[model samples]
Target: MDSKIVQVALNGLENILRLGEQESKQNGMGINPYCALIEEAYGLDKIEFLQSHENQEIYQKAFDLIEHYFGVEDDDPSVVPQVDENQQQFVFQQQEAPMEGFQL
Candidate 1:
């Protein structure tokens, strides 16, 4: 799996856990077991364990849970803003052109 994808998934899990923890604090309660397990699975040692095929399932489950909680479906191009090719070309042209009052 791509590291960027993994990082994003982990971030989602962390965000959910943090929110739950905050809510628990407000209610005068300790962190929940589900959050604790998820946090533990995201630890460095657990990440290393994910390198193995057997442990990959655990990571996948965690990612799936995070995605479900965050309401994130698979990647959708519509969700990401894209720059027009013409716009990028225009920007490049502007940068290549000499400025009126500045030396390059």
Candidate 2:
């Protein structure tokens, strides 16, 4: 893909995410529909891949968009932890059968 087109796409996505975030805050909602939709559509993966583009500007814009909207930090723990909704505790270690004995 062209660098210019990629930059434009990233900018547009950033704008949409920003607006969605603002709307979510104003509505006192915990979920941002726009963000959720993007995630569901695997947009996050594409954004991450774009971060490695040859063009510095493209990569930087991708990085900035992710850092600003995703709230990811360099100091974050490496473990892929999941929350135990039932017990309200953090499960840091990976589970082979995380859903074992779990009930809706």
Candidate 3:
């Protein structure tokens, strides 16, 4: 219901997909099966497939696995970085111009 909850769920899903990609690579597979499934659904504009009732069950199970394996918590406040006002402000300086006739 809450956006934060959705974000956490999405993060969990991403973690599962990342692991799938790594496993696929280790097995000499060209494409990750998990990512391929998402791509196929996305081609039909079916992004909601992840949120569908059936998939939600799978996602919840995968999320639980991710939490158990990675020690990730959806409600961990320390997960978010706290930036102070000074840290939020960044200043960039321009580099000096290169020589006009320089050749590579």
- Per candidate, the number of residue pairs that clash is 0, 0, 0
lDDT of each: 0.56, 0.85, 0.56
For model 3, residues 1-104, the per-residue Cα lDDT tens digits are 55456557667667867788789779998566776565566621323433343445545654544444334336755454555577795444446997697888
Task: Estimate the Cα RMSD of every predicted model relative to the unseen true structure.
Answer: 11.2, 9.1, 11.0
Q: Which pairs of residues collide in model 1?
A: none
- Counting only residues 3 or more apart in sequence or on different chains, how many pairs clash (N, Cα, C under 3 Å) in candidate 2? 0
Residue-wise C-alpha lDDT for candidate 1, range 1-104, written one tens digit per residue: 57567657666756766688678778887544445565566654454454452445556755554444433356875455555687673222233665576767
Q: Which scores better on TM-score, 2 or 3?
A: 2
Q: Which candidate comes out best when scored by TM-score?
A: 2
Candidate 3 TM-score versus the reference: 0.38
Of 2 and 3, which scores higher on lDDT?
Answer: 2
At residue 88, give the lDDT of candidate 1.
Answer: 70
Query: Residue 38 in model 1: shift from native, Å?
Result: 3.8
Q: Sort the predicted structures by lDDT, highest score first.
A: 2, 3, 1
**Residue 27: error of model 1 in Å?**
1.0
RMSD after Cα superposition, model 3: 11.0
- Candidate 3 ranges beyond 4 A from true positions: 43-104
